[model samples]
Target: MPELDAEKLKENALTSIRLGIEDFQRSKLEKDQGGDPARALSAVRNLFAGILLLFKYKIAVSVDATGDASVLIFNPPEVLPQADGKGGIEWKPVGKFKRTTIDVATIKKRFEGFGIDVDWPTIDKLQECRNHLEHLHPANTLGEVADFVAELFPVLREFILTQLNEQPADLLDTAWPVMLAHHEFFRDTIAECQASWAAAGVPEMMQPWLESCQCEECGSSLLRPSQQDIEEGASVDNQDNTFKYVCVACGHSDLIAPLMIKELNDAYYDDPRDGGEADVEECNECKRSTFLISEQHCLWCGAELDYPTCTFCEEPLRQEDQFNGGLCGYHLHAYEKAMRDD
Candidate 1:
């Protein structure tokens, strides 16, 4: 069997760290836009979770200031060794070999063996972010913190992609199983959030509103499986068919369409097919709140709703007014005058 490519493994580990940062940034954005701050904070914590995974693989190292001086920490996985006969020599397990004062030179040498370049500036930036997260509570604005995370994601992603691409086909194939596991873990987390939102009685219209406003990966729109789902050992295939929303871009199963009150109204009163009750509900983005009426104003905002252009003058209307009907009183006379010339 071919030996594992240490370099590729290192890259994959680092890439996971970067993806965690991206997840954090997305969560931060959702919080800024009036979504759940608790969920966003959880995403930030998951970044450290990713770091712990990387540490297990020896791809990255971490240092913490416990009291005053800095201390390097290792979190390698545990390994069992075969017992030797005479006086049974015990092998040093991976986890027990914690080096408080890690030799930076030695760590660099190991990383170099895996063909990873450890530049001071890059390391410094990563350290800065980690320090801010660890020590400072309100070090920067949410936007600023998010921007810092955004800056790190692509760099880490590219490095991992390159490492994967450089590896032999077999090595690359070996990584697929681990990658799939990670994706499933993230997907499950999303499902848990969805269950929470559903229980909270969040409106269905508001679900799409959240989707449009937040990142798809770390967005509140992504549903999380409930505690019941976990306890029942619910498999993905057994999820409620009506609850699934397939992604248009990546074809991922993440979102669940909520049952809206408006939809029920349309079903009984409007559409007779499924028996023709209202076949479709109102548009989520426009907040129509009812069936579309021809040449009528917005039901909620009372703005004149028009299609394409003004009905009289055939000129494009301002976006704010277009949904309402034509324009306001100011543009009405102008449109009428233009029609007279025609």
Candidate 2:
């Protein structure tokens, strides 16, 4: 194995420090101390730079470890040896080349090869923030900029520490207590209810989106499907082909079709299908399976579909375009009213 290049690591590490110190000072002196919205642009850019630098450091380490010209840089496959001579192929370097410059996409692809996922949403948000701030982000105040900056540090820190085998104390240790306090502040606000969930027996997977499934009146957890609707035949499993979630605390009921439910009479073993991805088209309004392609109407809600417009109201329906389905709320009500009067 080639010896790890201390010189290469040192160069990147030093650059990360130089950029980080300046980034920290701008956030503190300009944004925090002066409270200048004018400084918000520079401050946010600094935060982005620092975060990217940390990521760059991790990438440098990966390059040193493999030393494969093809794998690390843009060198050809002939320069890279294929077999590890064991069970797997290794990216072994046979020929030498100068280090290639890397950008965000390059670094992202590198980590992905190690089975690490890039958080595209977070990255997209920051890039958008940067673009907008240069053109103008909607939130330009010191606090607004600071909040955006604060949110990203923890995410980057976690990634660096987890994947790079580095400690915050050895890296950005000074920011540790601040991040801890930031968590605590949020715990007292948005996360307070979440902390108590484990004691209340709430599943962890559901915690992130718990607000969406909460009872509007009583604030009770409602992630589990309602047995009441099932037993009452309001949403019978086979007949209605729907799933219902009823709030136990306030009796608020919501129904969604098991539009994803599939039945295969024969040859399911030979030919497979994904019910959720293949056949299901959720409604834009209620987020349900009422978007049946053939029916052109939501049977449960009587919503007017995209295929047919309401004659009286002339309301346009919105549907998953590929499914070519839609429903107009106004016409459905009008038709139901006219039927009742008759």
Candidate 3:
């Protein structure tokens, strides 16, 4: 078998990286000119793959065990010492047909074992977004995808220059400019979004939800409250019906309740289609499914639920049992039995 040395691994990594960068450049250009958002999806996938390969390349270079690169192979077989004591623990692939490299999780653990300082969380974020894109993504997620790459670019640059001892200019070439431009654009837009959110005077408790909120129509997360309305004596109280938001990217407008409830449900609950239960219950006052059971309040109509006490027994009943007309479970059952007998 031809040897897969560190240099060979480096070449493969560069190839993947270059391809990813070219895709990213095209994606950015397309986005600027109002092209397909799916373009960024390809870039995200390629970039994530290339980043993993770069990490593997570094790990391969660091393995100095008698020039054996079997450590890079996934589930490398171990050769125990023979009876004659000729061989110690050695790594070899179990199957001759195909050899798979270590996966991302394994690579992360290996880096930890080797005391390599990689920004794993950042990488994980990219991987998460990539996975999301592969399954289901919004129509215009170019900004979000760019944000992921922008966050990881500096880390990749540092690793290439300092850890791998390779100049990014030589390796990345034209891709470098594309990465920098997108990064700068991401930073500037993020700053603008932050400023708009900050100036809107959204309550502290609602800030987290707003940060994660995406425009359902356009799939953009660049949503901000209507600051002009807020300035003109509008209230954003959780129960307030006057608050409105606008998606800066798509110019889509919506009321705070619908937007927040959707975000809250998405963040908290799994998909019911996949056997997930709804997190929020129906609000008694507004009759909307925005009553947060935990918080004991309606996100839509702002109804603070007060569980009624059982009329006969004078015991506090849970919200779910409220349908029994102020009766606890036992009392409700007893009343039903009494009614049957009568």
Top TM-score: which candidate number?
3
* Stretch of 10 with least lDDT, candidate 3: 89-98
Q: Which stretches of candidate 1 lie over 4 Å from their true place?
A: 1-26, 29-34, 37-45, 48-96, 99-106, 113-115, 118-120, 138-141, 166-342
Report model 3's TM-score to 2 decimal places: 0.72
Worst 10 residues of 1 by lDDT: 62-71
lDDT of 1 by residue, 1-342 (tens): 122333443566445545554454454444467544333333444543443334323443221222211212232335667567786866655444343323344445555655655343654554555555444333222332343344344333444355334432233253334334444554565555555545433343344433332223322223343445445554332243333444321234442423233333333365355554343335334454432333343332334444646666666544345544665545676767889999
The candidate, 1 or 3, that scores higher on TM-score is 3
lDDT of 2 by residue, 2-67 (tens): 333434554554455444434534544534465334455665665566566555556555554455
Model 2 misplacement above 4 A: 1-35, 63-100, 137-143, 192-342
Off by over 4 Å in 3: 30-38, 74-94, 135-141, 154-173, 199-203, 226-257, 271-276, 285-288, 295-317, 322-328, 331-342
For every model shown, what is its TM-score relative to the native structure?
0.28, 0.43, 0.72
List RMSD in Å for every model shown: 21.6, 15.6, 6.0
lDDT of 1 at 84: 75
Candidate 1, lDDT over the whole model: 0.42
- Computed on alpha carbons, the lDDT of every model, listed in order, comes to 0.42, 0.48, 0.70
Task: Please state the error at residue 51 of candidate 2 in Å.
Answer: 2.7
> Which residue pairs in candidate 3 have backbone atoms (N, alpha carbon, C) closer than 3 angstroms, thus clashing?
none
